[model samples]
Target chain A: MKLEMKDSPGQLVAALTPISEYGGNIIAVIHQREPESPSDTLGVQIVLEIAQERLDALVAAIKVQGVSILRLGEERLLYRQSVIMIGHLIHTDIGDTIGRIDATGFAEVAELNVHMPAIAEPSTALITIKATTRSEMGRALDILRSVAAEKGLLIVEPLAGAEA
Target chain B: MRVAVLGLGAVGKGLLRMLAAKPEIGLVLTAVADSSSACIDPAGLDPAAILDTKCVTGRCGPSGLTASDVIDSGAYDVLVELTPTNAVTGEPALTHIRSALERGKHVVTSNKGPIAADHAGLAALAEDAGVALRYEATVGGAIPVIHAIRDGLAGNRFSSITGVLNGTCNYILTRMDDEGLTYEQALAEARELGYAEADPTYDVRGIDAAIKLVILANTCWNLGVTLDDIAITGIDGLTVDALRLAADQDCTIRLIGEVVPAENLLRVAPRVLPRNHPLVIEGTLNAVMLSTDMAGEVTLMGKGAGSVETASALIGDLIAIRDRYVECG
Candidate 1:
């Protein structure tokens, strides 16, 4: 199960409570995010084994805890969005910047690659985000714009060229 | 299920405390065996008297409480072995453990010497007798490295494992680098802090890490690599200047244990890692980094030592075994 949980303390524990209450054994948890982002939401991929009868109760319990269930089946990486950031990424604390983008409710920054020439020079970061839907992707970009404005950085939304 | 703790040392006391706290686990403490007579009480007769009359019931005379006594008594469904590390003279504990397993009882231990030296033989015995030989606390103290590799990451083809296997050595190095202490000063501090043993050779000479590496290599890569195959290096010879130099270059000097298999060469070594590396940030804590072709790199980090942490891992293995028994039966 892939879940998008509110990026807050004890949210992971709250989300897992129902699984344990329903007698679900969590085999593995895969969570990766940019370290510097505090508000950045996290994508949790859990592999669990529970009875078929308890599956509905488990999902209901998670929903009660306000956790967004993104994908229910075996499919991994159900949603993906790519964005480009242009500005002084290194000067503005790249880790914290990534955290802000991830802290948004709609998306998580899964991958980021930055190019910086000098300590004081502006750099560009190619960030790939994962979200539940296209609307969530737009909301994530809005959060990124606010963060960029506050950090004196620039955000360049990806443009799709006309089809041939 | 009733259980008996054979040694009331650090690990033994920790196990007692953990088992006592878990209400879901129907554990009854029936007996205890310790070499020290100073801890035993003869008046109350019940072993619980010594534990403030909380859980333990009967008291065995001493460490001489043989396997036959524990098995024939039929008071315990499981035997916990937390004796000191002595592969040569510790055969009695091994004997008791084997007997327990053969008699259809479960066994949990934190003794690395026996497991490193004779895991195969004991595993076969446990399988034949339809019992469990759980030793999660033996390696990496409390990090769950053994279980994570054996079960959680079992699906992946483990290509290599690199870690700072010894907490004492890591502590010594961390102090030397951070505080500018000399090797002797750091060793003295470690001894004072109870991190290093009185002799300290096992931890300082790299043999400790080698044993852990050998176990991981055997389990993960199926290489059967022994302590002799590992190129062991200690932090004894390193100077403060070298550590400072490494720190200046965006790297930290750590005693890393690595098991790498590429093409024909299988390698295990203790090397330095950059500061940004996850293992470097692990600091005094124990961390194991595993690399696989499919999973890329996965690192598990947590407390490497301490009685409670190690005992918790043992309890986790015990619960898993119990659940499996319930499923199978």
Candidate 2:
């Protein structure tokens, strides 16, 4: 998150202490100062990890410290998995297939590299999906499996290790 | 110790050749039977002569006798059953192994049928008869996975057994991935190389791998899962584009059989794995990864099947029986 607080001695510490109180881990604190520009407020960038449920309270707590929130960029999806799907993808409404995963709210179809052979031949696609957690990724795959089964398509999942 | 070998197929012939070559092992063949004939010599039959006759005439012994006759003759200390697997019924091999166990004779088999069909029943019969029933050649040929679980990792609890248990599927996938061959093209190449059968349905359809997984799952965790319990998705209609897609990410596809007893999950499917993963071995080679409490992850790789490779497993079991059971008598 980026923050703009009043340029003062204890203002930086005041902006940082509430973060730890809310059980957030501050990974890095970037304080960039410009020698040319004279501004009353200081620009600070913070990168941290916190539980999703505590994020709202964390933002409110930081705002109460007289710091104006510049921008909050939280990566909602962290877990990624890739699968291969084969069948008549275009004929089966490919948009609807991707739409189902995006509709899950916790997961989204990130990328798809499709290979189409001759006309009417079965098409193959490599689909990458990102989810908020491991179980959410699994649920997304389950959704894809049901969709594939309905469309007479074959879904190839990973023999997952920690790396896969 | 006296031993009788049933069936004169490649596995049977390979066992005889090993016995003939290794006189130091001191395994005396008392009776030998092919599908059409049986030869018994309580004084100890000659292994080379049996193989020679089998090679020349395609029949190992005299006519008008079946494998059952040799089993009832009671002329051997251990019965090595190596008949072709009957995936559905377990067949004559099942009855032969049961008869031997009932008669207080040690039974060792490379056949997956009887063991997959009725492992618990046969083991109980062996225990009641005070004999040993060992089928090390069932799952991963020459890999000694069953023995490793029963002995080396005896106390460790396995959470899952995942592996490329079928060679025909692996071979086809390997060729397709390496050379960019279509499924039919790779299968044709596999058949030409004798790595696949004419029918190929049993292997390509994942039924062969499922049988092996069922045998291991029942043996290790005693899940009582049969072939039907497994959710099988074979490599029969796999697209070459799938392999290329996997390759785009430095990954490849394999027909993996996985058994996670904790999840009550048994499945055989084409699973994606990294190129360097232990289970991503190429060709007809078999690989197994056992996740256990004590050992962490144990990966075993070896030849899945060959006449001599499977014969090696039979010999190990035979020698084990000799040292532990036969010699005591």
Candidate 3:
């Protein structure tokens, strides 16, 4: 979020205090003084990690500190997993396969890299899924497994903890 | 220690060759038998002469004698069962092991059939008769993993066991990743290189790896699950594009057999793993990762199958039994 506040001592701390109280983890705070003109109000950008439900509370609390809110942006998806699928991907309704994850609002297919050699030959795809949480990622993989089983496709999941 | 051997196949011949070379090991070959014939001598039979006979006449001894005859009333203290495996029935080897155990004789075997069939029952039978029943050659040949679980890591509780138990499937997958070959091409290479069998269904279909998981689960956790309980997914239908896709992400696929006791999970499938993962061994080498409480995760890697490699496991078990139970003359 971007905020415009008084260019004075203790005002930066006042704006940051409400972020923590409302369950927001502050990642970065950019506050620079311009060399050409010294403005009465200072512009600051704060990047934070917080759940969507708490963002409204955080915004209201920061406003109470007499700071004007400029803008708010969010990157919701945090967890991810990748799996390879092999079979007749296109013929088996590829759009529906991706829509299955998208329908689950918490998770979605982030990318689908398909390799199609011939029409009759079975196509292979690598699908990467992104989810809001770890449990939701598991649920997304479970949905992928069912879709594979139904479409006679082979799903090769990455070994858990292999990356570690 | 007087010892009797059954089944003069590749493993048997390799064992006899090793025992013949190392006489100071104190394991006297008292009786040896091929499928159709048996040779018994209370004063210890000659392994060198018997191997020569098997090579020449295609029989270890006269056809009048058989393996069951030796198991019933043989001049031996240890019975080494090396018969062909019928994973379903665990046939004649099961009965042979039972008889030997009942007679207060130590039993060691390379046959997964009998052990995978009735491990607890045979162990109980051996306990009742006061003898050790060892089958180190059964899974992960020459790795000594059974000993690591049952004795070396005895007090530690194993949470799970994950491994590449089948060598043929590993060979095929490794080739596919290295050469960009199709499944058929890799399998053909495996057959030409002697890694795959003429009928590759058992290895390629994941049954071989699942059978090994059953043995490990029964030994480690006493789960009592069989091959039927394992969910198997083979590498037969896997495509080259799948391997390439995995490679794009700096990963590779292997036929992994996982046994999680707490979850009652026994699964064999092709799973993507980081290229440098501990279980991502190449060629026909076998690797097992045992997750234990006290010891953390311990991995064992070695030759999974070969004439001499499996014989080495049988020999280790034999020496273990000799040092613990037998009276050396």
Candidate 4:
């Protein structure tokens, strides 16, 4: 579960109480980005197992504790898709492009290898993305397409006969 | 509980001082050991030199005063190994560690050589003897990498573990890049600042990082890759100009130790990372990043090395082991 909560003292404990109250043992809690950073809110990703009927209660309990649930769903990204994006990747702000794809709930860019020939010329990027389902993979491709259009970069996604 | 310090070096002295401040822990320093008369002088030591009141144990000679001598003396329940890393000279310390484990006494160590060289053997012995052998200070100083991987992230499937494990080399390289200091000047500065050793080859040539990588690899992946399996490249060749170029491109050149298992092979290397990248921004501060299937990428950053910081790790492990023993009982 990916949760976005207020950067306050005891906020993490507040968010975690519901998990324990609902009989969920938290396996891991990963807080990405510093809490003091103004531009970025605290992104907490927790791994826990709960009964299917109690999961709704867990989410509701967390919401009652004042934690904003950004994305809460089953674990995805077990399957991976490797693609090569050939275009002016360097000139087109490749980091922003990659960030957009990662922001989508379905896919995460696992590995990115970029080759730059010259400062002004186009560069090619080899990106490997992990997704849960094929439909989610298609949505991620759409997000990447919009990012590419905005940045004036071309993307060669999902090589021939590699769809799963 | 009575505690006997095996060595009176920086780490051992720091442990004595920290134990003095924590009255709730109910620890008593019974004996202290060192090779020279320097151990006798407790003046100017922090925490008011509580160990000075304790018995001045005999010198750490080659043959006399074994680690078992201190353990068998019946004055301590825990053994803290703070001896310097020399396989031959430190063999006695390892012997003491094994004996303590065999006798079901908890052992905590800040010495990397003993843990890096004999982790599996010692772990097996500790398991067989039903004792705790905790070495959190061996890898990332006080960063809690070992416990974080072994306990915190126990449920995750760890895919890869990477980090900048050596602080001496990182400090020298960061100084050279940030201040345009020559290699000799940086080396001199690191030595003056007590970061680098006299020879400093182990840290500069990536051998130290290799040892840390091996520990993390064994802990996370159970791949059993030894120190020889690492493809180590240090920061000796990195120049200020090269660092500047990397920084100009929104990237930083750090001596990264990476272990990636893909295509049924384990690979380790030092690579350049983007400035926005977590490990690159982690700078001077030691950072270990574990990429797992569930958590994506998790990075932990803190002071990687220092006498007090590393000693604190050792003490934390000691406290944890003690608590576990109480709970078990």
Candidate 5:
């Protein structure tokens, strides 16, 4: 689960209370305090296991705490895919491209490597993203494709079922 | 995090000092044991007083309580196995770690006996119990070679591994090269400087290096190799003339542990390496050359063995376990 909430005291505990109330076994919680966006909000990524029947109730309970549920699933993000992009990454704003996928909360940019030969010339970047499920992985790829198309960057996506 | 240390040797005391130095980390040494006795406190104990008592009284814990009792007391969150290495039987240390894992406690060990003898078995046990059995200090002391292979170079295919594994042997070989001393003369000098043990069969006979190789082989390549599988040769036979001959050729003789997974070969023997070779590290410094497909040859060099150095590795493992617990929660 990915959560975005205002950075305030008791925000984390308020967010976690729903998991316990809904009988979800939390496997991990990656809480980032420093705001990474315009909104002064923290991103909390939680890995958990819960019954499908109780998910709706859990979501409702979490929403009651004024927490924006960016992503919620049965398991943690595990599937990984790497894509190579060649274009004016910095001038075209690669940060916006990554933000689009990351905001979806279905996938995260796990690793990135860039080769900037010159300031004016086109640069190359290798980005590795991880998602929770196979269907989510396909959606992440579609999101990347749209972003790359909008940015006029050539993308080399990972082959089907080849993503680590 | 609560901890139970099994040995009160130099490494164990060094670990206590490190833990005591960082009181804000919330890691408490709740239990400690020497071979003679054991001590336990649900709350944290005063490490300085414990050291003082051990030093002045020559007893680690109260009478009659063994290391096993401290382990099974259910007082510690992780078991710190610092007992001496017994490569033959993997003894008391093996049992200590096993008992901790069986009870669902994580383990961090510097003892190479259990890892060299049954790394696979112990790893399987830890997996079965959903805990960690980390022995980063068992091989390269403070170099973090195991962490480098398992975590830092994750997903890379390791082609080969070569290392100056034993510090005592490296010291003796360095002395022989610098002073043009004979094998026995170098060995005696190393003993006098407290570099080699009084009974230096393990270091001089290549057994220690071979054991470290077995640990690395089993970890990196999943090769279920043992001490018997390694082709061992020591520095005992290298004379001063050989050293001079290598020097004349711009080379130096050093005990090298090589592991080639492609050929299914692992050996610990003296090799005449060029002066510029990464393995030509001088004195007691150890270096491991990890030949990987992606990262190429990554050379990790550091102090191979010392109380504080080995304690640094142990503290790294402990903190890793602590972070794992924080994540798993």
Candidate 6:
């Protein structure tokens, strides 16, 4: 879960109360102090496991404390597929491409390999993307295709009927 | 499962004996090669009878089949590499490993040259081919140090690793310390006992220990380091006087391999350790001490090398692969 809250002494405690009240087990909480970007709120990411029935009440309780929930999802990634991308990978903002898929909280770029021959030549990379299900894999590939098309990159996907 | 073995040395034959002894493990020897020739049989060979014939004839196989031909035969699902160590080129061993992985065959090896030379590259190739490359015997003979670090302490990060890796060096040094013998006298005794090789440069010059250190460091830290990165000092220059002086100081001289990834330092040299130091192993025993975050300091010790001891590690890897394949299926 990613959230935004006012940078105050008791803001973190206030944001975490709902999780405890809803019987959610907190795994870890990452709260890095950085200057406010465009909004006057702090960004925090919390990893936790909670019962499905209490999720609605948990979200409601957090909003009662004026915390903005930026992202929230359960962990379910299972299947993985490895693909290769060839072109000006570095110049095309590879980080942004990965972020777009990861933002969904259902897929992630699990592994990566890149090769660059010269300063002006195109680069090649072997990428492994993992997802929660077969349909999520299709969504991830569709997102990758759009990103690659926008950057004029060539993609060599995993062979059909291949096991990962 | 079908298995092919390359390099029919002592360890190779030992592995065959163990496989024959435990046929329930489901590994069948389909091919085997010596230095000059190879024998291929998809239906499997009688391990005891073959050992007897090779012992009497001085070699095995049909005179002309090479290592490459055995790989190309495509009769096995796994390749066990028991070739000699060539730290300089990692030659035929490296080539053979690459060929097997490219053909999508799992590999279990006791050879350290290929691992010390190009482990990261081979690991990448194995990943691409979707096969497993296991080399537990490349380090401590039967200690299972690799699995201890990679699996048992999977959640912990290591601060440093120190070990007594070469048994031959340890045997020579132990004799020098206990019997007050000179380096030459102890080395001669080691050779007489078959502990030291005829040309003991690799063991005495610290190259063998250094190679094992490289393999462990690369695997543990994913450093992609080569042998040239380490600073090595062997026991060739240590004299009896130094050993006596260490004894006076309540310390014994032992060759130690130390790696500190945080400082990007790897060194192997004769160091004076207190008599009680965990790494101060006696005789041919090998020990590795890993300083971990969650588990404190974990030390593992066992026989470092022998035909049967090394075969134990090879068979352990084979079983691990088989179990994983079953789980995945």
Assess candidate 6 and give its TM-score to the true structure.
Answer: 0.66
lDDT of 2 by residue, B186-211 (tens): 99999999999999999999999999
Candidate that scores best on TM-score? 2
Question: Regarding lDDT, does 3 or 6 come out ahead?
Answer: 3
lDDT per residue (tens digit) for residues A1-164 in model 2: 99988888999998898899988778799998766535887889998766567889999998898888899999877778999999999899999999999999888999999999889889999999998767678899999999999999999998867246
lDDT of candidate 5 over B61-90, digit per residue (tens): 678998988988989889999998899989
Q: State each candidate's chain A TM-score.
A: 0.51, 0.59, 0.60, 0.50, 0.55, 0.54
Please tell me how candidate 6 rates in CAPRI terms.
incorrect
Error of 6 at B144 (Å): 0.2
Top model number, DockQ: 2
Worst 10 residues of 3 chain B by lDDT: B258-267
True lDDT of residue A118, candidate 6: 76
lDDT agreement of model 5 with the native: 0.84
> Model 6: how many Å of interface RMSD?
25.0
DockQ for each model = 0.01, 0.54, 0.52, 0.02, 0.01, 0.01
lDDT for each of the candidates? 0.69, 0.91, 0.91, 0.69, 0.84, 0.84
Higher-ranked by DockQ: 1 or 4? 4
Q: What is the docking quality class of candidate 5?
A: incorrect
lDDT of 1 at B252: 56
* Residue pairs that clash (backbone atoms under 3 angstroms), model 2: none
**Native-to-model Cα distance after best TM-score fit, residue B48 in candidate 5, in Å:** 1.1
Worst 10-residue lDDT window for candidate 5 chain B reads: B240-249
